[model samples]
Target chain A: MTVPALSVQGLTTHFFTRAGVVKAVDGVSFDLAQGEIMGLVGESGSGKTVTGFSLLGLVDPPGRIVEGSIKLNGTELTTLSGSALRARRGREISMIFQDPIATLNPLLTIGQQMQLAIAAHERLGKRAALARCTELLTQVGIPSAEARLRAYPHEFSGGMRQRVAIAIALLHRPAVLVADEPTTALDVSIQAQILLQMRELAAETGTAMIWISHDLAVVSSLATKLAVMYAGKIVEQGPTAALLRDPRHPYTAGLIASLPAMTTPGTPLTQIRGTTPSLLSLPPGCPFAPRCDKQTEACVQKPAMTLDGPRGWRCFHPVGQTAGAPT
Target chain B: MLGFIIQRFIQAVGVMAVMSVIVFFGVYAIGNPIDIVIPPDATQEIRLEAIRRLGLDRPLYEQYFTFLANLLQGDLGRSFVYNMPVLELIGGRLPATLELVLISVISATVLGVSLGIYAGYRPDSWVSKTIMAVSVLGFSVPSFWVGLILILFFAVHLGWLPAGGRGDTVMIWGVAWSFPTLNGLSHIALPAVNLALFKLAMMIRLARAGTREIMLTDTIKFARAAGLSEATILRRHLLKLISIPIITVFGLELGSTLAFAVVTETIFSWPGVGKLIIDSIAVLDRPVMVAYLILVAFLFVTINFVIDLVFALIDPRVRDGASA
Candidate 1:
């Protein structure tokens, strides 16, 4: 079989704070074929963002990838460090962040910043670099791409800045692109536009993506596959259509049920009970057991991930198994 | 941008106007220079002549207006001690101070910012701790005492440099410069280091604080994610981010040091404006005192204006704010 674009298995990242070891991302595993989009879904603090950072080896001090195997196009990345890892980052696997305003350097113009990114890996002539920057900007739907390159981050509106950030991320058109809530800070109209553009770009470039977000409607609209994370672990994952139609994990079911589209107008939307367990002091066995409506004696002991072809979940009593149980 | 510059220039003129008033009245309050200018044994006629000739015999308001009128005419009156124009007297001594203060502040900024960035980048390292410790010592030690110690260590003990005074001079563009000759460089060294000590500490602290904050920003993270090396990130991204505050302190320190590097100057006996001002004070030279104080105010206003422009140049946000 052809190698997948990105493969991650048993990835465990932890923050070694003074309080304790906080497992930010624990045992996350997924694979994305070329040009595929995998939506990493979770609430805040669910390790989705950390997972994305782990993929790029971008976790700062006090937090690090303590254990993991992140392979990009069958080349192991966890073993790479320092310059080796840095070389691979933007050239092979790039990432765009959540807030465009905060991500781009305020002091630098878009042209200068894009040029710097280009210069980091290859030595391109000045004319070629400018031409490449313009092409990427135009591709990303930035109007007057040539003139816009001279504009600073503050000069661009929120959406425009994010578009610039995306253009930078796609400069080399790496095999894997990990976007962390890139469109969340944008308006709905802009968000839809970016999402559609991103899908087209991924298809054209054959770049796989792990789109991390908490917004189910936004994710479901774009992602081909879905992975639901709760308390630093993936509880359910499968094709987007199959998972949404039949959420095997109770937490995933709750997330699907809470979406505005899933509920009648004016009715109270369903929400998962309780906040995520603190990573510093997680409950033994299943971390989400405290909030699970189908919690049983078996939940006291963590259930192994049960798989059916491409679909898999870690639940003792999955949704359909508990028919007539509390929704 | 032109409007902003014009507005700043008007504000600078307003500042100079207020500074002139304060200096004129303040010098007037320091007792009539005639008492010190004329000998006590001088006859009443001689005393009267001296007072009239010096413009001290006029009413305080008239004397202030005379000073302002003379200032507008580019004549800061004649120095009673030197019998030369006050501006000419100051201009003769200013180059010495300018060269010394420039060397000290520029070297301090370059060295301090580099060390500070390194310290901030690796705060837990022993080198950072040592740098911090040295900065604290720099802040706490008085400049006069530091000046003496510097003399003792470099001049007396090591015998590697001169103890005091501008040793030799070479004329450049009709100005006596001590920097050209090795002997002059040796002479200026101790005094410059002594003047730079406190400012170095300040720059280090400012840069360290700025770097520590900016290092954690998403801007740095994004740069790193773009595969920019740590050195590039620090130089290109961190430096620009931290430069506004550092440049502000640099301008302030440069002005303050140029205006009031008295303790170090006195210790080294370097013939700069600081010495000139002290000597003028002793002789109750009103013209020199008034002119010097006004010049100090003008220097500060000009430096601050330049710094604002620099802030605009480095940061588009500041540029927008200024034009708006």
Candidate 2:
């Protein structure tokens, strides 16, 4: 079989704070084929964004990738560091951030920022770079690419700034793009438009994506697969429709049940019983135990990942199963 | 933009108008200069003649209007001590202070920003810690004491440079500039450095704080994710983002240092406007005092205006607001 576009196995990243070590991303593993979009779903502090940052080697000090293998089309990324790793970043796998307002430099024009990004990896001539920049902008549905390039980030509306950010991220047309809630700060209508555009772009460019967001509904519309994280671990992952329809992890069940669409229109929405545990002091086995209604004594020891074809989960007593049923 | 400049200009004029009134009466309250101009032993005829010659025998309001009238006529009267036009006396001494302060402030900004960025970028490094320690010393040490120490070490102990004075000069644009000659440069070095220490510390603190904050921003992070080198990120993004505060402090320091490099000037025996102002105050030279104070007010207004224009140039957000 042809190699997957991106493969991550046993990824673990930790932040050494004075209080304690924060296991931001612990043993996250997944694979994305060309053109596939994987939605990494988690609440705040659940390690989804950290996973995205780790993929690009962008974690700052006091935080480090303690162990992992992140391979881009069969080329190992963890082995590279400094300039070598940076060279691979935008050219091989780039990322888009949550807030367009804060991500783009206020002092620089869109054209200059794009040029700077382009110059980072290649030595393109001015005319050629301009042509490429205009093409990318137009492709991202920005009208008047020529004049828009000279505009500052503030000149663009919130949605338009995100489009500019997307255009810049797509400059090198890398194999993978990790988007960290690129639409969370946008209006709902704008978010829908961007989601549709991003879906089309991924298909047209054949670029794999790891779309990180807490809004399961938003991700379900755009992503083919999903991974649910809790306390730095991926508790369950599978094809999006299958996992949403038949969530085997209690945490996933609570997330799906809490959605407004899933609840009776006038009734209170379902929510997990307890808050997420602090990463610094997670329980030895089953970080979700305190909040998992189906939690069993067997959960006192960590459950090995149970898999069926493309679907998998890490729970001793999963949803739809009696608490003491055979493993 | 034109409206903005015009508004600033009108504001500057109003400020000068107010300053002139304040300076006139303020000097009047500082005891009559006639006391110093005419000795106690002088005869009544000599004293009256001295008061008449100095325009002091006129009523207070009459004297003020006369001074104001002369001011509008491109004259500041004559300095009683120097026996020359007040404007000419100040103009002659301004070049020395201008060159000295310009060199020091500019050098301080450049060196401080570079060091500050390094310290902020690598805050955990020992070098950064050392830089921060030195900056603290810079803030605490008195400038006069520092000037004396600088002289004692670089001049007296090392004997590598002169102890005081503007050593030699080259005439440029009808003004004597000490920067051109080797001897003059050596003479200006200690005093410039002495003046720079406090400002350097301030700049370092400001820039360091700005850099530290900006480095954590998504702007810098986004730049890095796009594979921009660390140096390029620092230069293009971090520098521009941190520059507004640095520029503000730079302008303020430049004005303040120019107005009050008195201690360093005194220590170095540099014949700048600071020295000239001190001597005028010693003998209570009224014309020189009023003119000097007004000139200082004008300098501050002009510097602030220039800083506003510069802010617009560097930041597009400011430019948009300025136009509106």
Count clashing residue pairs in model 1: 0
Give the DockQ of candidate 1. 0.85
Candidate 2 chain A, poorest ten consecutive residues by summed lDDT: A318-327
Q: What is the C-alpha lDDT of each candidate?
A: 0.91, 0.93
What C-alpha root-mean-square deviation, in Å, does candidate 1 show against the real structure? 1.9
Give interface RMSD for all predictions: 0.8, 0.6
Mind giving the per-residue lDDT tens digits that candidate 2 earns over A1-327?
889999999999999999999999999999999999999999999999999999999999899999989999898988986789899888889899999999999999999999999999999999999999999999988999988989999899999999999999999998999999999999999999999999999999998999999999999999999999988999999999999999999899999999999988999888888788999888988899878887677777877778889999988888976656444
Which pairs clash (backbone N, Cα, C closer than 3 Å) in model 2?
A: none
The sequence of per-residue lDDT tens digits that candidate 1 reaches over residues B128-222 is 99999999999999999999889899999999999998989999888899999999998999999998888889888988999999999888888
Badly placed stretches (over 4 Å) of model 2 are A322-327
**Per-model TM against the reference:** 0.98, 0.99
- What TM-score does each model's chain B reach against the true chain B? 0.98, 0.98
